[model samples]
Target chain A: MSVITREEVAHLARLSRLALADEELDHFAAQLDQIVGAVARVAEVATADIPPSSHALPLENVFRPDEVRPSLTPDQALSGAPAVEDDRFRVPRILGEEA
Target chain B: MSLIHESAAELGRLMAAGEVSAVEVAQAHLDRIAEVEPKVHAFLHVDPEAVLVQARAVDERRAAGEELGPLAGVPIAHKDVFTTVDMPTTAGSKILEGWRPPYDATVTRRLREAGLVILGKTNLDEFAMGSSTENSAYGPTHNPWDLSRIPGGSSGGASASVAAYQAPLSTGTDTGGSIRQPAAVTGIVGMKPTYGGSSRYGLIAFASSLDTPGPFARTVLDAALLHEAFSGHDPMDSTSIAKPVPPVVEAARQADVAGLRVGVVKEFGGEGYQPGVLARFREAVDLLESLGAKVVEVSCPSFEYALPAYYLIAPSECSSNLARFDAMRYGLRVGDDGTRSAEEVMALTRAAGFGPEVKRRIMLGTYALSSGYYDAYYGSAQKVRTLIARDFDAAFHQVDVLVSPTTPTTAFPIGERADDPMAMYLADLCTIPSNLAGNAAISVPCGLADEDGLPVGLQIMAPVLGDDRCYRVGAAVEKAFESRWGGPLLKEAPAL
Candidate 1:
């Protein structure tokens, strides 16, 4: 069976918030299937007895003092924003339907 | 010899002695870039005025009788993935095409503090995703050895800049073999420090768990100098190691391997490996033995699964790390025709902004981490990751360091493997296990392959916090080989 179908790829695109084109969907479906098939080998040796490693280091609860530190000014913080309004990021309507 | 052709250490010495000014060193490199960049395409951006300004500052500091760092007044080509306040940090992606970062990466800030003059930002794979710079949205960087071939990537520009003599030192980040593979093909030294040895704050993320910033230079000593200058504990990076940085510079200077035990990885040779690359690596091992080092064969059985494990784990982490690039914040945003919703605009912007390889990984990551599939894909991959780390742990107990050919082959012609993701990924086959295990690894140019006459790298792997061992062995190999080749391997590169 194909590891990934075109419909599944489109669903993944939507989940990833990427509006992939129709051609891209077909092409990616084929490539992703092959890659997924190859990587499936990982499951072959990942027995339940073996513990998973989320990170290379065994770090935990890294903390810093709760004191305030100097930070970017509002202007500096929003300098690279695609759109800004009143010292805040401006985006298209979030809740409203398209006009 | 031209100032541009001098090593970083040599340039620094000359500058400190007042024989050559920092401005002269910077200008010489700028002139070299101007002459060769059209063909090499090593740099994505160069501001001569800004470069000279920094160089002039260094000269003034020296004239005022202030003591400076060992690398004071030397010029460096910074990989574009590191955030730089003065220059655009593109990560070779169009999404952040002209985004001027408000902060410098810890590596960038430390280099500047060490008094190294920044020449400019060099090119890289988009977000350091692919094995070749072919994935760069800005266009690929050509290898200085053969313009038609790739300078192994995602750190291709950093390696190529040093190889071409446009800059004596450069910074690169290795998530897999991004730094070493490129350094191998371009005939330079690249070191991937033990994870957490260098801070990653302000570095554009790829796979946060696996990403590590490192150094590239023509000599082991120079690479070690840069490595020391930018490494150490940083509160800014939560994962940064709290211990003092290993004495790599001293180790490089020692350049002796007498009585040290070296292990040749049993799995890295034979089938699928190029005969010429294997031949060169074997010779390097022989040289180590002749230098009084004890050599043995060690097998890390789980290493065979490194590639598949790395592919899953990197993309799984990248899927989360790259989520910050949504259209609303900073970077390219499209499809907001005053009528579309924010969500629609974001989707359109992302679809247009990312390259094919980046999109493929994002989708794959999403699929792997999605509901009902996470356990089978991502969870299993993490288990294999544990096994890989255990393999390293077990091997380190028996050997001081493990050796292998850095990559499977020398530089392949550009565009040969562009459409084949698996083929491109194969370039990093020997270097991935270290990243998965967070061990220190260095790739030093061993010799030119017999078949193609291109450079092949001998990889030296050391245990965590044992980064100096790699340098000690590397410098010994470098000294021995330079004696045979008459000079650095890059000297043989065709003149631009």
Candidate 2:
């Protein structure tokens, strides 16, 4: 069986929020299938008894004292925004019909 | 020798002794960059005036009798992936083109605090996804050894900067083998300190679990100097280790492997490895034995699965990490001419912004992380990660450090593997397990490959916090090889 079908790649692109072209969908489907097939070997040793390691180091919740520190000013925070209005990020319509 | 060609340590010593001013050192490197950058394309941005201002400040501080760090006056190139307030931090992607970060990456902040002059930001693969740097939306950085070949990436520009004498020191991040592979091909020293040894607070994320910032330099001691300067506990980074940074500088200066047990990984050699690379690696191992170090061949069977597991896990993490690049916030925004919804704009922007490899990985990650398929792909890859770490744990029990060829071959030509993703990934074949296990590893040039006349790297791997061991062994092998070759391996590189 194909590891990833063209339709599945399209679905993945949607979930990934990428508007891939039709040809990209075809090309990536073939490539992702080969890649996915090769990486499938991980399942051979991934038995139920073996535990998964999410990170290399054991981490703990790092807490800081409830104190205000120097932070980016509104100008600095919005400096890189593609569109800014009133010191806030301006985006297109989020719900309902397009504006 | 040209001032630009001197090591960071030598330059700093000269500056401290008043033999050369920080401005002079910075100008020498800037002049070299001007002469060679058109051919190497190593830097994405260079502002000579800004750099000289920093250098002048260092000179003034020294004149005022202010105590300076050991590397106070050295010039360094930072990989563009590290955000910089002064320079546009593109991370080699058009999506972030011209985006000047409001704050500096911890590495950048620390380098500045240490009085190192920031020459400019070097190029890299887009979001650090590819091996050859062809994935860089800007352009590929040509290897200094041969302009037609790659410098090995995604830290290609970092290695090339040091290799081409544009900078004596540079910083690079290794997720897969970005640092080590680039350093190997460019004939320099690159060390990936233990994961979390350095802060990643402002580094543009690729695979957070595997991302490690490190140093690149012309020599082991210089690499250690840069490593120590930027590494330590940072409360801002939740994963930052709470302990003090390992004493790599002292270890590099010690440069002794006497009585140390060195294990040669059995799986790293044989099929698919270039004969010349193996030849140099064997000679390095032999030299270690001659230096009073005992050498033994150790097996790590699970290593064969590291590449596959890495491909899955890295992309899976990247999918989640890269989601922040929505057109709503920073970076490139497209197709939002008041006709599309927020979702449509985000989709259009991502598709237009990301390079092919970046998109490919994102899709691959989304597929792996999607429900129903997550268990077989991402979950299994995590399990294999544990196995790989266990392999390292087992190997460390028998040896002080493990040694192997850094990559399967020397630098291939620029376009040889660009079209082939799997072929490109093989460049990290020997370096990935160390990242997966979050161990400290360093790549030092051993010798030139007999066939290609390109540099081959001998990788030194140590336990998690045993970063110093890597420097010790790397320095020993580097000294031994320099003596045998009559100078540094980079001396043999053809002049650009």
Candidate 3:
């Protein structure tokens, strides 16, 4: 059985917000199947007792005083926005068709 | 006697002594970039006027008797992936094209504070995902030695800028082998600081766990100096190491490995390895033994699984980290016509803005993290990661440092493996183990391979927080090789 099928790739593209074309779906399905096949060998590495490492190094939460410090001004903050309106980022409507 | 060929150390010294001015040094490099960039294509952006403004400021500070950093007036290249408030901070993708960042990356701010002239941003694989720069939405950066070949990526331009002598120092982010592999192919020096050793604040994320900002230079000592000036505890980065930076500069100057134990990784050599690359790596090991270092072959069986594990782990992190690029806030956005909803716009924007490789990773990561298959894919890969780290722990117990061929082969011709993702991934086979373990590793030019007559790299790795060890061993190998070749290996590269 193939690791990933064409329909699954389309499903993944939707989940990933990619909107891949018909050709991309076909090409990627084939390639991803091969990649997943090769990488699946890791599933066979059964060190049942060993723990999984979520990070390269152990991490901890950082704490800071509840005080404000100087940071980027609103103009600087909005400088790179694709679209801005009234000191805020402009965007398309949020509600989908059902709403 | 142009100033472009002078090392960063030499340039800084001359600028400090008042024997030379920063503008003069910057102009020489800018002139060289103009001359060679047409062929090398090492920089994605260069503004001579802005470059001069920074250079002139350095000279003014010196005139005021201000004590500047060691590399205060030296010119350096900034990788485009780092957010630079003054220049476009594209991660080699159209999504971020023409996007001037609101803040500088910690690395960029450090470079500016140190008075290093920012010539411009260098190119990389889009989001630092690929082994070669062909994935760059902008055109690929060509190898200086052989224009027909790649310069090792996603720091390809970072390595090429220094190799082509356009700049003596450049910054790079190593997610896998981006820095070391490029340095190996270009006949230069590159170092990946232990994860969390360098601040990543303002760096555009790519596999946040594995992405590490490091240095690329023509010499080991120069790399260490740059490493120190920027690396230390950063309150902004929760993961940044709170401990003092390692004594890398001191180690580079030590340049002696007498009585030090060196382990040659047994798994890195053999079938699928190029014969000439193996031969050069063998010579480097023998040279270490001749210098009174105790040499032994060490086996790390888990390293065999590093590639697949890294492919899954990196893509998984990338998928999560890159979610910020939705069409709502910053960067490229498309199909925002009022009739369409935000979700539709986001899908259209991502599809139009991202290159194929980035898209591939995003999808792969989505699949890996999705339900049902999560345990079989992402879960298994995490387990493999633990095993890889354990192998490093065991090897470090027996050896002070580990060594291997930086890459499987020399720089292959451009477009040779472009269509085959697996073939391209093989280029980073020897370098991924260190990234997985978050250990300090450095790659320095060993010698040219006989087959392709291209430069080969000797990779030296040390334990976490033991970054200085890699530089110590690297400096020793560099000194001996320079003495044997009568100069650095880059001196043998054909003129552009």
Best model per DockQ: 2
| lDDT for each residue of candidate 1 in B1-496, tens digit (9 for 90 to 100) | 9998888899989998999999999999999999999999999999999999999999999999999998999999999999999999999999999999988899999999999999999999999998779999999999989999999999999999999999999999999999999999898999999999998999999999889999999999999999999999999999999999999999999999999999999999888899999999999999999999999999999998999989998988888888898999799999988999899998999999999999989988998999899999999999999999998988888889999999999999999999889888889899999999999999999999999999999999999999999999999999999999999888887888
lDDT of 3 by residue, A1-99 (tens): 887899999999999998888999999998898888888888888467879998889988889998999998999988888899999999998877788
Model 3 residue B244 distance off true place after TM-score fit, in angstroms: 0.6
Judged by lDDT relative to the true structure, which candidate is superior, 2 or 3?
A: 2
lDDT of 3: 0.93
DockQ measured for candidate 2: 0.88
Question: Candidate 2 on B334-382: residue-level lDDT in tens?
Answer: 9999979999999999999999999989988988888898999999999
Name the runs in model 2 displaced over 4 angstroms: none
TM-score of each candidate structure, all chains considered together: 0.99, 0.99, 0.99
The digit string of per-residue lDDT tens for model 3 on B1-496 reads: 5688888888899988888999999999999999999999988899999999999999999999998999998999999999998898899999998999988889999999999999999999999888779999999999999999999999999999999999999999998999999999999999999999999998899988898999999999999999998899999898999999999999999999999999999999999889999999999999999999999999999999999998899999998898899977789999987899889999999999999888888888899999998888899999999999999999999999999999999998999988788889999999998889999999999999998899999999999999999999999999999999999999999999
| Model with the higher DockQ, candidate 1 or 3 | 1
Q: Which ten contiguous residues of candidate 2 chain B have the minimum total lDDT?
A: B416-425
Candidate 1 has a DockQ of: 0.85
Show the colliding residue pairs in model 3: none
In model 1, how large is the Cα lDDT of residue B294?
94
B-chain TM-score, candidate 3: 0.99
